[model samples]
Target: MARFTIGYRTVKTALGAAVSIFLAQLLQLDFFVSAGIITILCISITKRDSLKISGERIVACLIGLLYATLIFELLGYHAVSIAILFLLFIPSAVSVGAKKGIVTSAVLILHVYTVGEASAALWINELALLGIGIGVALIMNLYMPNAERDLLWDQVKVEDCFRTIWKEYAKYLKEGDSSWDGKEITTASTLLSDGKSKALRNIDNHYLRYDDYFYHYFAMREKQFDVLESILPFISTFGDTVIQGEKMAEFMEELSEAVSPGNTAGYFLIRLDELREEIKEMPLPQTREEFEVRSGLFYILHELEEYLTIKKMFKPDPKRTHNVSGKRLTRDLNKKGSKK
Candidate 1:
């Protein structure tokens, strides 16, 4: 949320300039551009110099005008329009993703030129259009500016990870059902891993955007993410273990029940029940030895009833960070007793 306001503001400011410029041209006056620039100024002041969207707007306006001029009139090179287009666009997009870059600017410019018209009225109209578009963007987002687009995106990505991890936990539980089919588990695992992998991409983005403002913030997020990353793979393994263990338990129960009379086979239900309990209270290692032991045991126990019970009893809270020291995000959801 913090970052969103910043990024949105940047987009708003740029588009506002576009609209203001275009309107000024259309109106045969400079009213729109003046208004638009003022709007940008207001945003800049309000944002405490945190917003950097103006740079993009300036470049966008200049490039859009330039590209149109080149394609339609300025660059009357006889070789080929296609060649110029390629030369103009390829590097622009490659270097900076076309957005706020030279390539996309050229594309927008070309679009304007192709639309037809080049009189004084037309040029003014074009500028006005640009200014008006930019102005409108600014005005609408005036109250809710995003000075931190990238950072907010990072937060969004991190939140997604939390959802994915929970889903994975759920998937692992599903594996324990006697009638469980592997398809759902596999699909869930795929989604879980995919979400986790995607989460990493945001970490770097977050670090890049926020590290400058807050000391050690990026480092801490990175460490937390690292720990979380390790858990994903472990979770997958543990989930599989749970499926197998519960399946074994169920099989034993069925076998014991099927035994016609008192026989050695009838004790399978009792043994299965005992195994189920051990899995529930999975201990997080308090010491190095404990850590190693639990980590190892996790693989074997997710298949147990104890593991399933505790996992169900203790859902991870989005508002809370487990086993982390220092500042972290919190959840408003009900807190289950600690598993560790």
Candidate 2:
């Protein structure tokens, strides 16, 4: 059974709806319940989306009032007239990029239709309702819980998965036909996807000063993941372990240990270059099988170098150093727990 818990969005919606309805009632507005409904509709997952939708809805509501006033006064406010009005208004709203506002506008239009008049006082009441609903929802959306902590947790999971994946690569090279199920690769893909989504949400939360640092970080890691996927076939083709395979496996172990958000890629790149030169000096393969295995090792090394090169070109925000440190510490703790 799924656990029943009231999320923050639910709390905000309930509180915002209550406040809107109460305020509308205190002012003696007709159809005060509509204000609460509007508030509920306006509440969104991101502050930016809420603000954007609220603006669209407000503009569309005003446009709806205009259309209703002209149409109702001319067409006698019949049901067919309402259909004609929607046919015209829907197209107009869509053309103006107010498609998301159609529902809210329809609600306000129904209020005018029920009143059977397009009087100035009725429009004022509707405007007041719109203001109350949108205002309260905007205020509620302003208190979005900080997502940084959750994003940090996602970052840790993604990094840990990457480390495990690289470790598995090293294991495969060192001991061909091992029992590793390649689960870490799938887990890393999922974790990277989820982390990137959370990072984008974090970016959306900030309106003016957009912090896309985490988003870029995840994107870089995703590119590196593609390289890792490409290396899998090469790892699978090795039927017999050669001397070069063992050396590359040692390099993979070093790479796996250095899988972090830090700028240690340059150091590794130097080490990788030295390894490449050393491999070039090694004796020629005596058998076709050995030659194929050595060639696969070189391909794997090339891909690994690309992986490090990607990290080398990418730079993280200096201000986030402490946060990365905290994630690393948490990851280390989790690793210890898993070992137990």
Candidate closest to the true structure, highest lDDT: 2
Task: For residues 84-107, write the lDDT of model 1, one tens digit per residue.
Answer: 755765555445433443432443
Model 1 off-target regions past 4 Å? 1-57, 64-127, 138-340
lDDT of 2 by residue, 1-340 (tens): 9999999999999999999999999999999999999999999999899999998898888888899999988997789889989999998888888888899999999988999999999999999999999999999999888777677666677777787877787887777746888887888798789879988888878778898888888899999999999998888777566445788878888777777677889899899999998888888889888788778878877998899989999887776544334355796657865896
Give the Å error, residue 17, model 2.
0.7
In model 2, the runs with Cα more than 4 Å from the true position are: 322-328, 331-340
Clashes in predicted model 1 = 52
TM-score of each model, in listed order:
0.32, 0.93
Alpha-carbon lDDT of model 1: 0.43
Model 1, C-alpha of 169: deviation from truth (Å): 11
Q: Model-by-model lDDT, in order?
A: 0.43, 0.85
